[model samples]
Target: MCTLTCIAISLIIAATIYYLRFVRTKPKLDIPSRDRVVVVSGAAGGFGTAICRDLLSRFNARVIGLDISKEVMEKVYSEELKQYGSERLSFIECNICKLEECEKASERIAQILKEWKTDRVFALVNNAGVSNSPKCTERMGIVEYPEDELLDVFGSNLFGHVRMTRLLYPLMKDGQDGHNGAIINVASVAGLLALGFFGFYTSSKFAMVGFTDSLRREMKSLGKKGLRVTCIEPGFSKTAILNLKPQADTEFGRIGVIREKKSAAILRNAQPPKVIGDAICEQIFSSNNLPHLIIDYWYMRLVYLFLYYTGLDL
Candidate 1:
């Protein structure tokens, strides 16, 4: 009888803690106009560029745009991003997959900060990823999935973010008061949902998702105060990241068929990358304290819940 009573009490205590931790209501935040600094990788790409623009325009944040291609970023500045000007933006041409390059990039950012006299990186968006897809797993067995490609993909998407964060750790001056820095990792829905013939891409995203989760814990333990790590899982956004062929193509080869199918699915559910960029901006300024952000269309929330409850591998 006493043991049963003790068990009931413990259950009640656990329930109360859970409710307080997750279900407590909080007021919405309206952030003040303050200086914010951000770094965005893959910034030459459509989505990455969009995100950079969103942060700059919406939040008035200083942004460092990093990418392997200098010409694309230059064009972006001359054409689409001309009005934003140089006062709020800087570009670094670097291969994120290379640790040396990322280290150098970090040094450059530090120099910029020292010149400008800033304290920390307000947010770092790991928005870079690649997939040599439309090729099935069997076809890619040796060429793409070989040790080198595997290392390259994982290094760029997963470990590169790790290295960047490590290099910037000392400068993350968030959480001293009500402020905290955020790290957002842009993962795909494909990482959570298993898809056939996407072995390499899926594997790399899963590793990234895992790495972000583990890093979140480590950062918390280190008491980064207001430094928060958020993994962003988004459904398909229409971007060149999908590597779509032009609409004029007539013949459907094996690769074309695969791309056609994937494109159709993505197109149906795709939201503008601006939507995601806006959400990320909100996260940086809003004190909502969300664990992760899922940008999806249609019934994706239900799908995520169902998959999670079913014990499916992430």
Candidate 2:
């Protein structure tokens, strides 16, 4: 009897996977270069820079990168972007947390699209964020949790995405075919698994997942069939966040200590930056066919499956 019950459960689960993976959605398609323009935040970092490089190399699409640190942009690219066919790549110093700066960045990209005679941007990648320390309510003890710090992370990871999408909707919203564009928000495994070490960071990313899910539903309701929403949940790719300053740090010099250490350990076990870069490019080019993707290691994927199906609710 138990064996039969287990078999029945297995069939039900397999059917659900089949429906979600194939039946409910249309077959995936790629976005053509003629209609592609990519706007990526945090382009100064290792993963973001790789993503930009892949986009240019693969799609021949015009790319605009926004970062908080001008030095990061200059140092990270260092004329390498110029080699990817001149003037096709550009970078602006803009903090995602600031709305006015985000608007200015959007305006700059809009102008470029206008010059190219492109009606809308093909993709917007929201990858800017800060790692937060794990300080749950129990860990806080008598000390009050800093709501401002929490809000700061949310501003960059969540609200900034909201503002960017709201600003660029017109460009991505399809006029003729009703197929719009794509929005890719870079989340983390920490968000899904609730990393005990980075409680606040995990919370912010979890919120982002919810935000992206709801946004995707809303877009569908609005009949924007062409618009795609993707949440990038990376399980530690080789990146330089180790040297980057933390958003909540009082002294930028010693920021990301725990994260840097943890990330260094993770680097020993993690995949290369190119793997994630290739995945992001795949997402951009093949989003029409497979809009929702969880790009991670096999073990992570198995754990994700268990959590998702078992309703572990991570």
Candidate 3:
């Protein structure tokens, strides 16, 4: 019994030390110089605005804000442009879900670069995304949801970003001068751990995570060393996504009502959007190459570790 106890304690200590030394250590990034351009989609949203502000204020990088909602985009521009300067900030009202708009936006960005005498796009932040509609209170089961709604979720959450990446890859690929580029995709912890009532959202994010991993491998195979791909999986955050009506009032509430309350309470202490923005900025500036980043508090990390080691699905 004494030997068994000692062995278990040793294993626990080893695991803990490994997690602390490697998993929690932030990598050092090479900061891009000023005068570079970064394209940020979903720029009007909470997290998007934070990323735009950080890039502009910290790196002085020119930012193009892309959004489907002109009103929201204009609002963000009006509030942010003056502080960041009009020359450094611009807005493109484009729906990323549409191929035509993605192509046109790419063209417009290229023209802007030419006019500015810049040669390469420093980074692309694929942040624009949508969750299931608040009105989707129907049975939380997959078959209960409308097919059209599922398509919309997938379009906004996954395919739109794919389209944008394809359209912008040429400018971001390794250039003659050997300037490397970065692509940051904002996924969610739900992408890694499934939630009961969030079937559609979880599925979309899971697909995103898989797609990002595959893209990274492909880039390496093609010798695109300068280009880096990163996927950020953020835990519950204090964003509009959690601002839905109380779960008890919704139709899907019947499925996981208790878990909903618990989740809401936990999310009450969730990290702010700025935390995620800072993580992205770190990735952009860091010289170290990391494929995935989890931006959440320590407690969440512990939970993830437990589930991962136990082979439990959430």
Look at candidate 3 and tell me the lDDT of residue 132. 73
Candidate 2 has a TM-score of: 0.77
TM-score of each: 0.78, 0.77, 0.88
Off by over 4 Å in 3: 1-24, 134-139, 224-226, 245-253
* lDDT-better candidate, 1 vs 3: 3
Quote the RMSD, in angstroms, for model 3: 3.4
Candidate 2, residue 19: CA error in Å?
12
Candidate 1 RMSD computed on C-alpha atoms after optimal superposition onto the true structure: 7.5
* Clash tally for model 1: 2
Which structure among the candidates has the greatest TM-score? 3
How well does model 1 score by local distance difference test? 0.69
Clash count for each candidate, listed in order shown? 2, 4, 6
Q: What are the per-model C-alpha RMSD values against the true structure?
A: 7.5, 6.0, 3.4
In candidate 2, what are the lDDT values of residues 1-314, reduced to their tens digit?
A: 99667656755774565457535754344556543788898888767888887887776778888898877787777666658543677778888788999899889888888776767787888888776322322222112347665677678788888899899887777645444577888887666766543536678888888888888778778764547777777776666533333333323223434445654654576667777777777676664535355556665565555565554543
What is the overall TM-score of model 1 with all chains considered together? Answer: 0.78
C-alpha lDDT of candidate 3 relative to the true structure: 0.77
Please write out the lDDT profile of model 1 over residues 174-279, one tens digit for every residue. Answer: 5454667778888776667654444367677877788888888887886647467777777777776555433222232344455557547646767788877777
Q: Worst lDDT window (10 residues) for model 2?
A: 134-143
lDDT of 3 at 185: 88
Q: Give one digit per residue, the lDDT tens place, for model 3 in 1-314.
A: 99667656655764694486347766675665487788999898778988988888877788888998767787756866667765788788898877899899999888877876886788898998776753454435555677876887788789999998888898877665555678888888888777677658889998999988988788767775647888988888888777654444445666556667666667788889998997887787665656877678866766655555544655
Q: List the candidates ranked by TM-score, beginning with the highest.
A: 3, 1, 2
